[model samples]
Target: MSTATLPRTRSRSRVQAPKNPRDYVRIGLWIALAIVMVIWAMPMVFVFLTSIKSEADIFSTSSFAIPGAPEWQNYAEALATGNLMTAGGNSLLIALVKVPVGLFIAAAAAFALSRIRFKYDTLILGAFALGSMVPIQVALGPLFKTILDMGLLNNPLGVILPYIGFGLPMQVFILHGFFTQVPKEIDESVRVDGGGNLRLFLQFILPLSKPALAALFILDFVATWNEYAIALVILQNKASQTVPLAIQSFQSQFTSSYGPLNAFTIMSILPVLIIYLLFQRYFVQGMFTGAVKG
Candidate 1:
């Protein structure tokens, strides 16, 4: 056979290679994932398109239509009118303070639960697991009264304290699961080296659990930043409001101003997007590793 004919034959054989069921399954998953992503992104796309349009254009045109004249000033108007910067700062402060402190507390609790054998350890872990399932709404009434009695209403601490409490169960559960996967030999070695539990936890376990901690930090920060119900109850004043409460107030104030409303909505989520992007590399790995056991 001619060399050209041999090349053609080889190409044909490659093209005609048999497909595996697994290959088909993988392709199907990719297609499904793409569809799911598009479905999820549609609303954000609509919001973004609306954000850039003139007020008149928003009502006159289709939801997804590009603005004929992009209204860049909408962002400026939103920022000034909505007081979103102040609210965002409040949210950021709460997140930065709450996430680290909550994580530290959770890590300590998780270490005790996973590493130390004590009476009622199983019961305590079970309680935390059950606590994770309890709705925040269930405790809202009593929580409000407690905050009120303490004169913490409209204070950041009111929100921060509750956020920490609500966050602990899930954080402890995730960290405990991850900590259990750490080899017992390391714990034994640390003990043999005359290291106390605090030293082992602070130096060894924490260093080893960076991925899980990063994942929890991102998740917790986002939750705290976006939380509204508890914040609404605790932070009644405009100055103390977080992003979600501020957005609600902004929407109320700008009932007819669609452009500014959409602009504010987009801006409110930017911090969360930044945070997720920063830790996304660790998110899936941490979730899977921690979830594997619990």
Candidate 2:
């Protein structure tokens, strides 16, 4: 009986705030980046999956399928059968010696080109630019002959010498761009302090150029480590073979053993990956800075 005069209540609806145009662009960029990352990572994921799978599992199941039981022995087999230890050691030594020596030579050349104005500087720089564009294949015959003549064939120096030669033009180009960005005042101040070119270069320029140097070091090291064509030509001796050559030999030797081959590949990639991860911060900065500054 008391329900005669009950009031009706209106329900309130929630209204959403309008999205900014920038929000959509940000979301689009993030989605694009995610897709790119997935695309890039797919091959690596498959390689890893294959590396741990049994030979039967690799062929029997889907490419992306997880293995029922991981064949951990694949790694051991790869290393032992490939003689990868000695190959890896040779690669490490080549990279260690080549990278620093190459960088120093490149830096010095860059310093000369960027600083001390001299006759034919532009012409010389043009020549280096020309040199960088020359394909390695074009020089292989002459390179091989020269190495043979020098008795450096089957020697690490054979590979090292060529690597340094090929690597220089690009390294010098990058370092020169970066070195030019250094203020003239710094060079003047160093000279005012009675510092010669060597002191200025060693004490000031090199320290200031660390980002560019680190970037070049990582790139040159990886390139040197993974180099195959030059290494194949120079390092004929099994004892002197680098990782890439050894991996090629391993593949040939173990044609049907996909598991161990994949494992060996993954192992070989680890050093370059580690080097990149260690110095990744400087890479982007150095590249963009060198590019944009000049």
Candidate 3:
């Protein structure tokens, strides 16, 4: 009776080991990536280590080693003596006003270029695309002089306007690509319901384009936050200086406030880091959204 029936059990698959030189490439790549990551992170590690140490320990101990005790006062000293507070406020004001305003304008322009067919759509979009290639330095003098003549120099408007203007080209370019990828059927459907271009943009395009907007917003915010050359040129009033300018002036004036400088640098970067973390989920998605049309 036992010989008449048989039960089958599944055989386990054997694990394969690397058998040739090329088979070891994956391991080599992982090692190389780890090494590169360590190298990339070393500077930040050094800065953080230096920021926590007293000036004495900063110089006495290994640059990457932990401090005997954290010199937390360095942050306070930096905040007190440095123009960081004013500069930070100015930076915040500029970014807050500039990012949303700039993104809206860019998104509108992109919508017009991508969704609304016009006689010169290609020409206009190409012009903006080309503008992104022009060096900011090329316009620096003209921008400064225009701001000076308009009595806006050393004012928040000067920074905000230029930021919006310069930020537009790239933002529009990005949004245009994303906008084109959006189904024309949506626009046609909206128009069939008696919607105009404005309604189409606000109600349909914007809601669907949040990731693209977030990605662009984060990038533009970082650029505006850390802008040095333009802010240095336009924002001459120490009271109106931005973080980059404040850090520059701080370094030049103090010369030896290494710990405070490091602390200030840390503090300055936190906002951008936080913003990145908040929007990071959309970052890769938005960046590649326009890459292919499927």
Candidate 1: regions farther than 4 A off: 1-22, 290-294
Q: What is residue 251's positional error in candidate 2, in angstroms?
A: 0.8
The residue ranges of model 2 lying beyond 4 angstroms of the native Cα positions read 1-22, 290-294
lDDT tens digits, residue span 1-294, model 3:
456656879899998976753747888899999999999999999888888889789778888888878999999998999998888899999999999999999999999998778798899999999999988888899999999999998899998999899889989988898888888999889879998998999999999999899989899999999988888889888999999999999999878989999999999999889989999998878878767767
Q: What's the true lDDT of residue 143 in model 1?
A: 99
Clashing pairs in 3: none
Residue by residue across 1-294, what tens digits does model 2's lDDT show? 556877889899988776844588889999999999999999999999999999899889999999989999999999888978899999999999999999999999999999989999999998888899998998889999999999999899888988999999998987888888888899899889888889889998999988889889898998999899999988998999999998999999999999999999999988899999998988766766645534
Candidate 3: misplaced stretches above 4 Å?
Answer: 1-33, 290-294
Relative to the true structure, candidate 1 reaches a TM of 0.90
Winner on TM-score between 2 and 3 is 2
Error of 2 at 72 (Å): 0.4
Q: What RMSD does each model have against the real structure? A: 8.0, 9.7, 6.6
TM-score (all chains, Cα) for each model = 0.90, 0.90, 0.88
For residue 163, model 3's alpha carbon misses the true position, in angstroms, by: 1.0
Overall local distance difference test of candidate 3: 0.90
